[model samples]
Target: MNAWLDDWDGNIARTKGVCWIAGWDGDAMGLNQAGPSIRCGSLGEWNPDERMTRLVLIGTDIDENRVSDTLDRCLVRADEEGTSWNPERGPFPRR
Candidate 1:
């Protein structure tokens, strides 16, 4: 399975309510979009061993500590996303 990530934008309603992340499970049936978009829960929940990344939305006004905790709770693996691309048209880079 694949992992999808999302962020919380600075929305007025969001400030008062819980923040939610959305993504494509690459499966949930829908219109033209090829991914399943959900709220706070993640598609990553389906794959316990999979690795997922989180990108904080720029406008979010929450504290950094809260963000870190959220990432730890949400990301599939606890490291940074793989940087750099394959030297050749080869496999994905290592984390």
Candidate 2:
């Protein structure tokens, strides 16, 4: 999670007209390019662990498939033991 944020911050200058909403363990962070405002809060009072991340991006001239592919690579895959696992390294492509 920390690594993802770091990469986003590092490349923020190159992004435009987009919004990102990420949730983890019931907590969520929101950022919009319109005003570049950042907001964070629990999804609800009765927070429960979903153990998943959700991101929503809206903008012009963006390739939906590419964005989907990029985010898909960050997801955890099921191992032989039936446990979800993320890669040791971040999946975001390097600039």
Candidate 3:
């Protein structure tokens, strides 16, 4: 999967949401416009040893500490189940 992030403007940048593509394959959808902010929760093959989430924000004057603190509050532990082993996608969010 691939992603492209674009900032529309400085005014409504914070309120902008992501757009999903039903069948996005090499620009075959024909919905090619501007300002695409879609992102995936993870990238590349799943690694059982490394279960992590990395979010990338496109803006000016970005503070690493502030973003990390805000994200810590926004996301919480889904469950307390063991995420040690999985055949398909290792270390999945507890369901």
Q: State each model's CA lDDT, in order.
A: 0.32, 0.38, 0.32
RMSD per model, one decimal:
14.2, 8.1, 11.5
In candidate 3, which residue ranges exceed 4 Å CA deviation?
1-36, 41-45, 56-58, 78-95
**How does residue 74 of candidate 1 score in lDDT?**
54
The residue-level lDDT of candidate 1 at 55 comes to 37
**Model 1: lowest-lDDT 10 consecutive positions:** 26-35
lDDT at residue 51 of model 3 (Cα atoms): 38
Q: Worst 10-residue stretch by lDDT in candidate 2? A: 16-25
Give candidate 2 regions above 4 Å deviation: 1-54, 80-95
List model 1 lDDT by residue over 27-78, tens digit each: 2211111123333322223343442333333333557677567656654343
Q: Report the candidate with higher lDDT, 2 versus 3.
A: 2
Q: What is the TM-score of each candidate against the true structure?
A: 0.25, 0.38, 0.34
**Candidate number of the best lDDT:** 2
Candidate 3's TM-score reads 0.34
Give a tens-digit lDDT track for model 2, residues 3-94. 43343432233332222223232333332332243333333322244433455554556666766676565554555233432223323222
